[model samples]
Target chain A: MSVIKTFGKYRNLLGELVKKDIKLKYRNSYLGVIWTMLEPLLTMLVLTLVFSELLGKGTKDFPVYILTGRLLFSFYSNGTKAALKAVRNNAGMIKKVYVPKYMYPLASVLSGYVIFLISLVVLAVVAVVRGVYPTLQLFWIVVPLAQILLLTLGSGMLLSTMAVFFRDIEYLWGVALMLLMYTCAIFYKIDSVITGTNGWIFKYNPLYAIIVNFRNAVFGQAPDFQSMFYATAFGAVLMLFGTFVFYKQQDKFILYL
Target chain B: MSEMSAVTVQDLGVKFHLSEQKVDNLKEYVIRILKHQMRYKEFWALREVSFDIKKGERVAILGLNGAGKSTLLKVIAGVLKATEGKVTRSGVLVPLLELGAGFDQQYTGAENIYLYGAMLGYPKAFLREKFDEIVAFSELGEFIDVPVKNYSSGMRARLGFSIATLVEPEILILDEVLSVGDVKFRKKSENRIKEMFRQETTVLFVSHNLAQVRSLCTRALWLEKGRLVEDGPVEVVTEHFEKATTK
Candidate 1:
């Protein structure tokens, strides 16, 4: 009940912060928010050219497969990165104000999530061009979307807290994200390359699990409920743990800052 | 915890770790922990200081530099946590620690009013209703449409002061904010604060100017090196502070 009350009190502040982030993201750019749509489409085209045409890999409608993975991974990457810098970037305000410290990371991740949602229009356009039509299964996309959002928020909170104490976390996370991107199977088929025991690399990663479920929904196939349940549980547990750690260490943040 | 008290602080203490070599990286921290080489010099900014302010009391915190006056105000305003003891506040408290600290340079002065207001926990509708008043008080006029990055420091400070003083909070925390803008604007801002005093709002102020403190506050709390030296009527405490400083 107290949590709900706090949320109600800060809802307007959160909205303003998210709006500021989105507006500043493309402020000086020539095409502005148009980049949101064009970025994904251009990435899909480039990846298809390299993987399908040059490398002679992938099956039918490979562009659709790549688009789904790229969009989800980009959201996760961008959301967590924004969250990582949220606290330090707003150090001036943190030192002067009495706002809940968690609001910074929460707002940053949420702003990135909004931009990610907008970019999905490009995914839909590419899917139609690749002869993949939306069906009733698309309704299930909300499950994977929620799962990824929770995971990003959880990771963002944890990273933001750690980044305050250790500035190296910014550099470390950049390298770790590259490793995670490879493990997510964004442009590769797990069955074609790695078979048998080696498959656990992708299996154990919650982000990969979410991307698979998301692909299942977009490709008009029933999502794997068991995998969805596991991914959701993983995200929920991480989120709870992240929140606990963030709350405990938040008081010390001012001293460090 | 009196019913009439606006703020109650009990045995308040704040300790800061002054590390000889700042270990800001995870690897160094881990290595130090493993080698049992972790060392920190604990410096107490405030120790065993306690006070109570009743509603409508205007108290000036008088202290020399490095006297923990700002730390005490931060604790009362709920911006910093006390290392020991507790502070309880019963009303809406607004701390004007540094005005315009939350402004986004990329945004226009008009956009920043809402942003900074939101940061101060004011509702969007309230800002919209009083938008003209804030702009007029800021004297930004046509510059409201211009981005804040282009604003002069005085112009930025004026905008921040205008938005923050819009709502008459129950407890107003001021830290040298009255000295904002030009000489004329400073007088105007001080008058605005005097108006809030008329509303019976509790105020905790920190300033170096003894004349300003005597004119604006009824009581004074003097601190010397993180310890309270005196707490009494403004005239008596200021007199003591003046004598001690000259010696």
Candidate 2:
């Protein structure tokens, strides 16, 4: 109960931090927020050309598929990356002020989530261009959206805490994320590449589960309840575990910093 | 824990593990643990320290370098946790440990007011009401819109001081922040702190300036290498501290 009360008290600080992040992200850019909508659109175009034309793979709506997987993966990657550095980057403020330490990682993840949401507009446009329109299933997108957010928050908290103690985690995570991207099947269909029992390799990955469920919502298919349940449970458990570890180690952070 | 006490610190101790050789990365740390080479020397920054401050009293912490004065303030301000024992604070306490530490270099002075104010736990509506007052007090004038990276260190400190002092906290913790900006602004800040003193706010101040401590504090707590050596009236403690240090 007191935890909730503390969060309520610092809600405004969280808002300001999110705003500062988004503002600084586009500070000196000529096009500013226009880049948010443009970057994903261009990336979708490139991926679509590579997968559909040169490689002779994917359906006609492969562009939408790539955008869906790309955007979600980007958010997880970017959010966790920022959160990994959040505590160390704010060592000055941490030493001087008495804010709840979790606020730093929470703010970093939230700021990236905000930008990710804005970029979703690109997905919508590309989906329409490829003859895939919004359906009643679109509302079900919220499930996967929330799942990804929780998963990112969980990983972010855990990574940020580890990062304070071990600087090598930053470099290690970079290589890990690259490996994670390939496993997520961002460009290829999971069924086509991994057959038989090996399919569990992709199915077991929480991010892959989320991407599949999100694509279902985008393509007017019914939500995948099985994958949805698995991903949501995985995200929730990680989040709980992350919060536990973060709080346990937070008091010791000052000594390391 | 008395009704008259604004702050109570009981048997507070803070211990730090000093690694003989820095093992900052995970690989080195893992190898050291695996090889049974993990060695740690415990260093107590503050130990067996206890004190209570009555409401509205001004207390100065007097100590030499490495005497744990700053660590004591950090523990009291809740920035650092006590390794043993606890601190109980009854009112809204603000620690001005390092001004402008929260300011982002990319943000303008005006933007930083809201950012830093929010960081200090001020509500947005409250910051809006006091925005102009803060700008005027900072004397940044038109430079309020200029990015902090462009401001001189003095200007940044001036803006930080203005925002931090805007609200009269129930307990204000100051660590040598009175001497900010130029001579004129320093005097202005001192006067402003005096104004807060008139409101009967509790203050815990740490400074090397004995004369200033004598003027601002009614009582003093002198520390030596993490142990409290003297606690008495400001003048008496300062005299004793000076004589001992000069020997």
Candidate 3:
């Protein structure tokens, strides 16, 4: 009921913001929103070709494995990257108007999620063509997907807050995302690369946990509940921390921005 | 949402710390922090300023540039945080601090109307009902569908003014916005503001134009170097400010 009340208050503003973001991304481009599908599809194809012989030795469904991990990571990266610029990009509006500060980051994350959801259609088609048929367990995909969304939202808020005060966050976050992508086990199996004491690195990566569970659900297996719990708990904690920091710091943002 | 006073300010102050060296990014900030190279000056933009506007009163803020006129409006509009003291508002407030604050250059005038309205917290349904009126008043006609980047500044101001004034707000905060556009639109907007005054809307306006302030507001507040210098009838304060400045 409270959620509904909040949504009722901001739905129009949020809708307009999301629409502006999506439209701006595709504006004047020939392909427009079709680029969302093409981008991932091409990346999946290239990675599948380049690494199939090299890293696909142990994995039964290499393309699906890579696609699943890549999409989720892309989802997270895009949301946070956009959010890092959200406050700075709207400095003009923030200085003049009094809308909730969270709306800018919220719109950025939602727009990325919208494109990520659309790209899933391409993932589904490619998986079926590669003989990884849809299974009943696919219905449970929402669990990890929801976790990824929360993580993205939390990450976005934190980044937006920092980015307003420190302009370097934009570039620093790019480097961080690259490291995150490599560590997320997108192109390799965890057992092959993560060995000995370093095993906890992959095991503790909240994104890795979410991606692995998402991969399981896609492979027609019930998701690993422990990983799901870990990722959800991680995302929930970040969400709380992010909200707290964002609200506390937002009032001072105009001064810094 | 109180009824007694539209806005109440007490001992408000805003201090900005102006750093000597610019920290352009996080790397520089971290380096400076680690090296203990950070230094800044405390610049007080507003100091011990206090004022109150009762419901249905039209008040104008007059001062020279950097007199904290815009700073005062921003603090009252809730866009800027006060470093000390407080401001309280009881009614719905709409601020026209800057024309086209959220307008996108690539977006059509019509699209910007919706976007700007949404930014102001109005739902699309409300904008839809007033969409035609906004367009007609702006006289933007076929240009409404054209990207705002191509429009002149006056056209953009027209669109912004139209949307902000579409619905009468309980409290209207205007900061040098009425002087926008050409003479005809200026007169039109001045008349529209007069209509709002007739409707008994509380108005807190900031302007350097003495004639406009004298004609539009019954009371005036004067600021000098971040301090409130005078607050009284419009004629008295404006006359005193004019005499002081000319001397």
Candidate 4:
């Protein structure tokens, strides 16, 4: 089935799952929606402290750098991790109900977007406090960043589905992301890694471009257009191919699960 | 049986993969994969299970516990895939396979109308119109806004059954879920089932209650150890099921 049509088919179920995921995040917490801010806020503070005070890096507006890293990481980690279990976690629903199975993964991706909205508010406030002016160019950051989401979600669907068959992938993904943190220039300066051997790794890694794009757009700098182009094109293909794999393998999911 | 076949299954089968020990983490999974130590065991939850039912053909699947009756219905409902053979369902096959499997415990009963309504194949708009009706049926008036996990078993059953039976599926599959509710709620559920049955939905009902089976089903398929032991008029098949279990 075409990706567009399949999504078009499970639209209602997709929306419902997104609602459920969002509700679940704040469900039992006494502070409710406040916890959403607290995660990135606390993480940002700790990361700023380490990189500025401990590492002695040339840290100007440490909160800005920390928040930037956190926002992207939140979107990627939270999105990918949630989507990775989309099929296996909903086994009962999959076994009992006949939804377009790919809806489960897509919902996970969409749920991440919903949380990103929360993180966006927090990031904007931090940026304003740190004296970062809004660039009209920064608004354009949304385009490439959205592509990054597509790439992660599309690939995450395939990965999560396959993870059921090969259980080691989920664990492997965690370590891989840790490696990615260094390459994406999440904590450190992007220019420092833009040379020679480090340059080769950053140029090739899809997330490197995504982090650069976010820094440029949200933090008011220019992103590497070549990396963004590669990320966008690759993301489109992955969404198509990923949904296709999910469609083909969805029938066997209940049995395997 | 009515003239229109709403549910059909031919030579349907199921299999499972079994491992030597419990698989807890990545290390165990890697070892299992590397050693080729995972055993593929065909449990045959349903072996060559074939049946057909026209619209409004109330049928009961009678069997001992673990006789693969629920699996058969699930296959027909498009929930479980047949390892072999095919199942052609003419219309919406809502398998209330187990009570409240679709509801998220964290969501409110009101929220679950949309959630479970989606599961039963009804759109949000359609459920919205009948939201009040479902709530009234659940008898969870004040608690509709509260989390479902906090609800009593009976409350959960009411909520589950109400959402399940809200929309009429062309093929409805029930698997011993209604029996768990309180007597009053079960009576309510039975009435709702009877209403949908009267309206000519092909019903694949699975339960251990012989009287309910005889009263509700025009046909009966008796399954034993994943094999069909009898398929005929309810009187004959059910009598065989009773005798086999008693013996």
Q: Rank by lDDT, highest first.
A: 2, 1, 3, 4
Candidate 3's C-alpha runs over 4 A off are: A1-7, A53-60, B1-3
Minimum summed lDDT over a 10-residue window in model 2 chain B is located at: B90-99
C-alpha local distance difference test of each model: 0.92, 0.93, 0.89, 0.79
Superposition error at A33 for model 4 (Å): 3.1
> A105-213, model 4: which lDDT tens digit per residue?
7789888887887777888888888888788778877876687688778878878778776677788888987887777776777675566656678777776667777
lDDT by residue (B88-113, candidate 4, tens digit) is: 77776667877788888878889988
lDDT of 1 by residue, A127-167 (tens): 89779999999999999999999999999999999999999
TM-score of the B chain in model 1? Answer: 0.97
lDDT (10s digit) by residue, model 3, range B69-121:
99999989888999999899986788887888779888999999999998887
lDDT of 2 by residue, B163-236 (tens): 98887899999998988899999999999999999999999999999999999999999999999999999999
What C-alpha lDDT, on a 0 to 100 scale, does residue A94 get in candidate 2?
A: 92
TM-score of chain B of each: 0.97, 0.98, 0.96, 0.92
RMSD to truth, every model: 1.1, 1.1, 2.0, 2.8
What TM-score would you give candidate 4 relative to the actual structure? 0.90
B138, model 1: CA deviation in Å? 0.5
The positional error of residue A15 in candidate 3, measured at the CA in angstroms, is: 0.9
